[model samples]
Target: MYTREETIRRMNGLGRAGAPFFFVISHDLEHNLLFERKDGGQGRSAAFSLPLGERGGLRDCPPLPEQIRFDPVPCPLSRYAAAFSSVRAHLLRGDSYLLNLCVATPVKTNLTLPHLFRFARAPYRMLLGPDASVSGVHGRACACFSPEPFVRVRGREIATFPMKGTADAATPEARRWLEEDEKENRESATIVDLMRNDLSMVASRVRVKRYRYISPVETRGGTILQCSSEICGALPENWPSRLGEIMMALLPAGSVTGAPKEATCRAIAEAEDMERGFYTGIFGFFNGRDLDSAVAIRFMEEDGANLVYKSGGGITVMSRMEEEYREAIAKVYVPFDL
Candidate 1:
């Protein structure tokens, strides 16, 4: 584990030198992975950025063979419902305004980690470790196919897109329901407010650039509509020199952690009863000037011989246990090209 000061110094030095690098910051900010971009760096650390609708840099990484089958086995509804009830009870008692409750579902697949990496469909995807393994300090191998951006920095502008609502587009009324859903609207607004406050810490002129935009994501199960909002801010003149400090102030992304962050996170720990490790963490690349990153959702990690998929949704006082449980399970499928 690296000290906060050490992490700050390293990132600032690298950013100031105009060196290219990649970093993985965990949910709790207790564990971090940093690697220089040359020769893929050293040890069990690997990082790459693949934009949506493009497969250019993946020449060396071949796609999965057609013969390989993929099957995901999500957690049983009874168990998930029990956890959902616990979170709702906390909400009823005024413990937290909202919480992003998550669970790990075991998946059965014939393909390996490298094969999954080559075929996973998402705008922001990353795999870390040697031999395409995800095993790091925690001795677990994992990969992320996330559609949520933790933050992005370009010159003096900093922006973040917080995604909160989801619905199966196969339903004829999906669009209308998502746009009209009072619960989803409130959840998105809370996160947007939280993100605006976060940006105000090191940035000036923070504002919500976009609100309640629907983005359609095609997955193997079906097309799912996601609700997101864009928030932007202007950074200080010496932002690059304080990259580490800036990130620390906005850590554990507000969308995943919920409003009134600290208390919500504590409640999540008590409710989850499991280690998040790198599941909801943030990973991205820095080219000395511009930086891009994503929240580590839609994640799968290797635990011994089995693969576990981690997925979750936002919970509020208005949340229903049955719907929340279904949303968590519905997110377990991979978004393969259809």
Candidate 2:
């Protein structure tokens, strides 16, 4: 178990807190990786481009056999809703600043840690070398390993894209669904606005660089569409010193926590009925100069004899109980056919 102090030290040690910005690191397996921005310290760290001939280090570890499989275990949404509501009420009352709410779905899987890691995919198609690991119960399952998001920081331009909603888009109009889904659009807009406001805390000229954008991500299950918004702002020349503090102002990520950020986070915490741990925490490599990180989502963890996939969506006053409940469970999939 990682203590809060230990986690904080490691996070700060990665140089994400302060100036030489130019590296990428995953917070943990099954999490997102953070990349330094292009203008990162005058290109001291260039974007990590995969070599055309460079195949990821998947060969070092062969893929899992076809016969490998396991039964499924599920958790109830009413329990999670109750937990979310509890936290929501407290946050609404102004008891906490920001809270990261999470729920664990105990599941069974036959694949080993490495096998599961190889199954997930993203926009960057990470050059998976040996930098992967998993944690979970022995006979149950493991949290698929992953790093953080790819971030680019330059001068006063700080931008972030947080992925929020997910849906099975087997239809030819896959892009249409991502763009038109009412729930998805509503959730994305809330987060985009929240992030813009967050940047305003440390930056000027805050704006939405991009609106509801669709990124076609290839997962193990085929292709799952994810919607995101890009928000940016101009920081002061002395931003390096205050980078950590600025980020802290945007804790638990707006995407995971509904608008009226504080209130929503509390509700999520109480409704989920479980601690999020590092699930939705931001992670990545940042060396003072500029920092880039990804909101930890689409994550799984090891808990006793079961592999718990932690997932949820943003909730608003307009959110229906049944829809929100289904949304939370809908995120539990591995995004692959296996």
Candidate 3:
């Protein structure tokens, strides 16, 4: 565990020395962990599928259970409505243009975090905390399987893919609908604009490479459509030296926190009961030259005897309470194969 400044200094050193390492930073930027890529994760925690490379020398991927049992009990409707109401009130009051509201729902699953990580179908995944396994059940505590890429840096170019809207794939014309919906479009466009500005702070010639692109995400429960856009910028020649500083400039991710990042985050604290912890935080792997990372959505954590899945969606002035609540609940499912 390292303080923010200490973490930055260490990352600066690693990047400057062209050392490959994995890192996890908490949502509030309070706790940071860095693992050298040499020796296949000497640190207590293990991470793999880091977008840029794989974490080697891990236990073999286990086969899925014959009968995988997973059931998530959504947050109570009244409670979600109250939270939604609070966020809506903020939107109406014009304190912020958009605010992301989230909730923690209790989930029952036969599998543990490590096994869950193995079965996760996400592009980016991480497993951390105390040692745990099926028979041991000591509880590892934190597990993340994210489909959203926070940002990727290759050479002197930096790019970000911000996922905004989600729709039930079972719905007819969901792809077209998500692409055309006013609220969803507004949310995606706002995040895209916000990210462009974020990148512009550290890079030059920022631009939108793609807008409102749709991708399908499959989970054990069902498939859903995700809307995203790609934004790019040109990094300085010495970006490797300032890698940590660049990341520090663009964090707590705009997709999860919403526009006018600082104020919206404060409003989020007032609306959502549970602290986001590392759930929406950004994690990345710096492999000497290039960097890749993901926003910690599609995430879960262990709470005592209970397994809590934290999820949520963006809220804007056009957002409807019922739909937003439904979206949050829909996001609670595990990103596992059907």
Candidate 4:
């Protein structure tokens, strides 16, 4: 684990030298891994890459395996309800306007970590740790198949795409509902405002380029419509040399953490009663001149004797416990190109 200061210095130096690198910063900003592109030794740090379309030079991944099955047992409705109540109380008390609460659901699967990654289809994917070398079916590994970009920079332009709303796409009016729902619109707008503020700290001329837009995401359970917004800003001169500092300013991804960040994060910890570890974290690559990264959502970590899928959504004063609980459970599916 590198100290935040040390991580910043090292990233700045690498950025100045124009060296290609990849980094994963945990949600709490306590643990981080940074590796040079040429480093072949996997020490707690394995393969981390942006979605194929975003990576300029990385080779495309091989085809997925024939078939795989994943079975997940979500957190009890009562438990999620309790967490939701806590967040709602906080909202009522003016402690936070919005909070992103999450839970880990224990999953049973017939495939190992590598096989799971090979079969999973996502816009952004990452595999961390030494699980691939182990012959047994059981091991400690964390895989992130995410769709939201935490931030991306090319030249002097930086952009963040914050995803906030979700609905079952199979429903007849899913896309229309997601786009027109007052609650969902409020949720996405809040995060977009937070992200715009975050960017303004290290950037100039921050603006919301796009408002709430609906996109279809494919998952094993079926298609789900997600609402997202694009916010972009102009980085100050010599921005690349301050890459670490800039990232530090926007971390834990506003989309996942919530508005009024510090207080909301505290409430999240107190209500959830578990460390998020790397889930909801940030991972991406800086290929010499450009950077592309994603929020570590749609994540699964291998715990002893079980795999845990971590997922959640935003909570507000208008949020319903049952609706939030259902959203959490619905996010547990893995995407495959069936």
Q: Write the per-residue lDDT of candidate 3 for residues 24-52, one digit (tens) a residue.
A: 87888867777787754355446557768
Report every candidate's CA lDDT.
0.81, 0.53, 0.83, 0.81
Pick by TM-score: which candidate is best? 3
**What TM-score number comes out for model 3?**
0.94
lDDT order of candidates, top first: 3, 1, 4, 2
Error at 95, model 2, angstroms: 12
Q: Model 1, residue 218: displacement in angstroms?
A: 1.0
TM-score of 1: 0.93
Cα distance off (Å), candidate 1, residue 37: 1.8
Report the error of model 2 at residue 35, Å: 16
Candidate 2 local lDDT, residue 117: 49
Worst 10 residues of 3 by lDDT: 131-140
My TM-score estimates for the predictions, one after another, are 0.93, 0.69, 0.94, 0.92
Clashes (backbone N, CA, C under 3 Å), per candidate, total 3, 48, 0, 0
Q: Write the per-residue lDDT of candidate 4 for residues 1-338, one digit (tens) a residue.
A: 56678888888999889888888788888677777777655443365546423322223545454655578798778888888888888999988989999999988776655544555777677777553441112335788788888898988999999999999988998888887888888888889889999999999999999998778888878889888999999998788799999998898789998989999998999899567877888888888888889999988888876778889999999988888888888999888777
lDDT of 2: 0.53
Q: Model 1 clash pairs?
A: 134-141, 134-142, 135-141
